[model samples]
Target: MVYTAPGSAAFSRKRGSMADKITAELALIDTELAAVELGDIELNSGEILVGNAGNVATAVTPSGDVTVSNAGVTTIGAKKVGKAMLVSESEAVAGNIFVSTGADSAIDEVAVSGDATLAASGALTIADSVLDGSNVANTSPDNVIGAIPVLYRIAVEDASANNDITSTHKFLVTDFWFVGGATPGVAEDTVQLLNGTNAISEAVAKTTDANCLVRATQLNQSTGMIAAGGTIRITSVKNTNVAGTAYVMGIRVA
Candidate 1:
């Protein structure tokens, strides 16, 4: 290989070959780029092209509970943000949550105290059993009322036999009623709830003996407490011909 002048035949030939190779490479690149453009570059919801640390463009998708709007605003679904994503001053304690102590202060791990408490499993509980108007908070639902609903359990026994408050669990007998059943006798008789020999509720008289009607009585005495594994009974004095079911309503306290 001998040195040649700039306009020499060999120099021109070498330049032309170099130009041809560069043009061919550029044309191949253009064809590959066109294929990529025409192919399905479909991305899932909240997916976008992002340049990673390696300076390579990658298709990235948000978590299941996250959404990204076309306007570039990202939204996180409720209960989606975990403690790992939060800023905390130290290791989070069991049942403790991150909170802003004050403006311009580091986020702190604070335990929910007073009326409310959080469990290590992320369950929350309130010390108070009942909620009233005063405890209600102003919320987005407007006039948000917090209430603990009392669920009453029902015990039913046919009039043929007394519904022995035979429940294994302690039940605070609140209300008792009789429903007319098959073959209600001609004459109406008295029905009442009892704890041992003492009557817990006032005796209720049947509306009629035609197997048609009955009465309800609310136990107004503390004697309505049915001890667990204890004998609390319902006694009905209906005639043998009379048939009905007695329903005792109460809440399980234990």
Candidate 2:
């Protein structure tokens, strides 16, 4: 039998066994590190990293109109806001204003719908024409004639005949002038206005001697009003004297 020393082949075999175990453990560690690919790992554009409940990290892509912070809070982009309002191209007309329809994000340009008129110094004009006098909504003197003053003139002869003056506009008799006629007595020079059987001015005496008889000195204190589609009848009764011209003027205010 041979006696083996501490540094013999049997001792070398024990050392070789320990070294082989350590190499096997190092190989296992290398295999796990290669699976992670730490050297080749990179984040793509618009890509982010998120962690799940198990603490496992994962790559995520974000939507174009929104962004997510590291804290997981999301926010919308400015251009992606909903229901933005904008004006159209039809707002250039004069005397016109823009109005928003009840519809969502809808608007239009139109003439002022309020009861507005052109100023004395304003040169602006609307495309809409005057309303007809017969329209019930167009009240006379102001709206019927577009607030314009009008005069209805007729020559009256001193005869026992009634002269009826008919007008297409509703007006207010503002003034009267007897140019060529002499002053007739009461019940002799009579002028009356009727608005569909309603007497606006009844039997007003014209007693100014060859002059204008305004409402100030007339026997009737009522405003001589002629409605739309009404008539004014003037009857001259000569008190043994009949000669001259009578001119009637009225102002329109509809």
Using TM-score as the measure, which candidate wins?
1
Model 1 Cα lDDT, one tens digit per residue, 1-254: 22223445544555457778567556666776666752367765557889999999898876578778755788989998676687453666789877888979978778998888999899999887655322432222122353222222233343544656454555566567766555445444556778777788876665544555555545756677666576666676755444455666554444
Per-residue CA lDDT of model 2 for 155-223, tens digit only, reads 666665566767676567665544435544443655444444454444455554555353323423254
Q: Candidate 2 clashing pairs?
A: 140-254, 141-253, 141-254, 142-253, 142-254, 143-254, 144-254, 180-244
lDDT of candidates 1 onward, in order: 0.61, 0.55
Runs of candidate 2 exceeding 4 Å displacement:
1-146, 182-223
* Model 1: residues with Cα > 4 Å off, grouped in runs: 1-162, 186-188, 209-213
Collision pairs in model 1: 159-244, 184-242, 184-243, 185-242
C-alpha TM-score for every candidate: 0.35, 0.34
